[model samples]
Target: MQATLTVSELLKRKNFEHCEVVAGKEGLERRIKWIHIVEVPKVEHLLKGEELILSTGVGWKENEEAFSSLLQQLITRNVAGLCIEIGSYTKSIPSSIINLANKHKFPLILFHQEVPFVEITQDVHTFMINAHYEILARLETYSRELQELLLATHDLSDLLSHFHQYLQETVVLRLKESTTHIFPPFQQNNSKQWSIIHKSIIDDTYTESKKISKKIQVLGKEYGELYVVVKNRRFTEENMLALDRTALAISQHFLRNLYIEEKKKRCENEWLREWIRGEVSLPNIFHKLGKIDGLHNYEGGGVFLCRKQEGVMWEGASFSYAKLLLTTLFEQCGFLLCITEYRQNILFVFVNKRQKQTWRDRFTQSLERFKKSEAYEKHAKLFSFISVGSFVDRLDEMEKSYKTAQITADICSEQVSSSETLFFHDDLHIYRILSLISDQRALHEVIFEYLNPILQYDKTYNGKLFDTLKTYLACSGSKKETAEHLFVVRQTLYHRLAKLEQLLGEDFMEPRKRMALEFMILAYEQIFIKKKEEKFPQCSEIEG
Candidate 1:
């Protein structure tokens, strides 16, 4: 708050025909820190000497030059204002002065009531102090209300309503972030939503954007995004920040709640998994747990591994959102499967008479697309990897199938992108280990040896012979096929194959070596891998 001068009040009470406000605050406090005074009415005569001046209109009474000169002098004078005393000489204020004041946003005041100049000066000086006090009070009150909202509620909608009620702006949130717009199912193909909303944001075509429009950004590492905008017709920057704080606060609480719920659900799910597969026969298959469709039908299934990134999902997305997203993912994957949460992970089992290779491929593709779509984020954020178990024939072996899918998915996670589909045994060793090992630790140790051999080879030789061996094995011991696949001439391929065989001291065609090699790959995934995985892990056959 600066020095204030109320012309009407000052004139009515006392006389301070002192300095007139020519272009600044009238009844407002003025902080004209360094000021001056001038009475000249000529452009050349008056110079840039910051101050306020008192005038009687003698120099610019009627002529146009006089009128223009007086106005120009004020501008040139660089004074705060032209406080004019109206009495015998100057009867009424000039129209040009009024016009100029309004044009330049120059503060000006006319004194109609006769009063001494000295007394008016004293009143302006006093009013400035009170104005400063009032401003401080408003700021403090605003801060308190904002703080209250942060601690009060968990529900964003309710919190927003509270803001609308108390905060006074017509606050509303834009759920589908401008960056990512997910239209209702049927209307997605409709481009109208883009023109009406999306394009506007991209171009900042928010020409119609109100004086204050606030936005909350929702981004993705791979998939579609979701933004929540809280709009108000009368919104101001201050009020918008308050709303942003409230929205952010509520979102955080919701996420924290969900994080806890997800853990519990995963725990419950694993218990159910153990029981369903008969790994832990705490009770009968039907014990307390309700039957899930296709539950009994799955003789064998796969596990999908995923990670929902921090702050990527809805602010309020709790375990409920996680569960819902999983169900939707599998559903869209074309499986009528049962899903369970297992500690920071979501697992799904797909069971139907041996699903067609093509259908499995398609299902995996759909999941990949969905993960990359607006429905979920990608790369542990929303969309993740999936590993399917090899088909099993006996119901008694269901537990084996479950563990295989889980471990295979984990192995697949290290080698492929979360956007990948199925993890076949050939691609990831964990699948083989999950297939072979009855005990987890033995599986881990064997894998450690296999990976270590390759690790030492890579670190020591800067060589790629191990990869060559893996590829040859993948081709099923056919020299021609392996050579063709590796894109080397037959003789060159033969030399490399011979060198590999010599190093390992075995024939590439021997069943024993092939089996050991395959099992080792599986063992490596289950035991040696650093991070374990959930059920569904994107295991795309494509490299990139």
Candidate 2:
């Protein structure tokens, strides 16, 4: 039912049969909420909006400016229209007043015969009251039906269908992960047009189409958006109320699903923790997996660990959002993922659903896309490092992959400053070897025996010998390349090289010695340099 009473409709009443619109014909569609009879010159404070005002010209009959001011104020207050009695207080309507109303598209009505103000107010108020009551009753019925639908279905798409049916308009639900669900699906050829509309709405730049949107939230955080396109008519107050209720219902659905998923994840996390710790035997693992729905036929898999940056907290809604985003991204890339939280880090176990070995390329591509996404840009500060383990052939060997990924994360945490956030186990060639060595004393001795001379010389003289040698080795002993890299002239580089040879030995460039120097350089930078920077941050900053 239409909840609004427009000026055009009110003009058709028997009480207004002698009334004629003198100006602002374009505003006939203005909605009237109530009727007021005002004889005072100042009626601004008495009006809220959408009220059809009745007045006699007696208040400003002698002053045309005061009457014009009154009409201007009424227009500013957005009154539905003004009706002036033409018989008693004034014989004719002023041409200036007619022009003013026309200029602002404000409806102006003149009654040739006087009508009872009390009777008009009673008739209009009673009609509006009944309309409002009917609207409320309809809303109550809608709320009841919505509750029934919620209890009967677990799918959000089904809920969207119900919304579409009730509103009889196009509906769109867009989630945070860029997933869109649309009702009254468009034709295949119009899909592109819909995509454009969706993007415009998300960007908040759309103006060509009339639509209303509300945020759908979960746990007090915005999870998605609900949009309704206004087709051929304006939305009444009842329509807005209905949209609000729908948004709330969708939020409740999201909360319920999250609660159920979280409960299941807790159970899975415990089993995964034990399994990754190598406490479960292969036979028992197979038996437990066989009981699950889809884990019985897994071919191969790998593990990855995500560690938050220091001082960044991950709990509650933020953690849930991240988990859902990761799950959606990985599943779209053709991997079935199992996620758990352990030791303040997020762990993911992903298995290839296909028999082919193409998961690596797909995983890499997905990570690249995720890094470029808006979600990552907003939450980048929360993440510090991502360490990917080697792909294993069987589920039993997953423990080894998890351990390697953990080791990679540990290595990255202790290294000198680096902008890279993603690390691969296979790429940790020398770091893996260093991690395997149990004797820290021997490792320190190896670093000291190879690079101590240059390090001590640089510290004693405040020289650039250490940097020069490192760059020279990285340049493969190419003097020109080293000079260019250091932004130094050839003479300066030669002098530094001569000094470097003097500090160590002339035979330092031999194959065996060069290899040792290279390895020790990396180890010293990863271990000792980072510690020195931490101890004397000011000195490190000055040196850089």
Against the reference, the lDDT scores of all candidates come to 0.51, 0.80
Model 1 lDDT tens row, 1-544 = 3234323343334454443544444422222322233345555453444444555556665455675667666655544555655665566666776777666655565555555545544455456566656645654564466557545755455555555554553344455533332222226666764454554445454654333334443221112222222333333334545555654544554445545655565566656567446576423433433244423333334444444446655234443554545554555555544566555555565543335454557556656655565345423454444565554444335566566666676556665664565575445544553645635554444544544555566558855676677778888878888878888888877777666666666564579867887766545544444335522121231112
Q: List TM-scores for all candidates, in order.
A: 0.35, 0.55
Displacement of residue 156 (Cα, Å) in model 1 is: 5.9
What digit string (tens of lDDT, one per residue) describes model 2 on residues 1-544? 6656899999998689989999999999999888888888998988899999898888888578999999999999999999988876778878999999999899999988878888888888888888889989988998888888788889888788888888887788899988988887777789776866676466566555567889997533578899887645777888788889889889889877866776677687888888777788878767776664345666677899888557665667656666666666776777767788888777888876666478788888767767776656667766557888888877777899898889888787766256887888888889778777624656776676677677777778977898898899999999999999999999999899998889879988999998888888877766666466542123234335
The parts of candidate 1 lying over 4 Å away from their true place are 1-211, 215-237, 256-302, 305-544
- C-alpha RMSD by candidate, in order: 15.1, 11.3
Best by TM-score: 2
Residue 409 displacement in candidate 1 (angstroms) = 5.9
Q: Model 1: how large is the Cα RMSD against the reference? A: 15.1
Error of 2 at 187 (Å): 29
Q: After best superposition, candidate 2 residue 330: deviation in angstroms? A: 1.5
Count steric clashes of candidate 1.
54
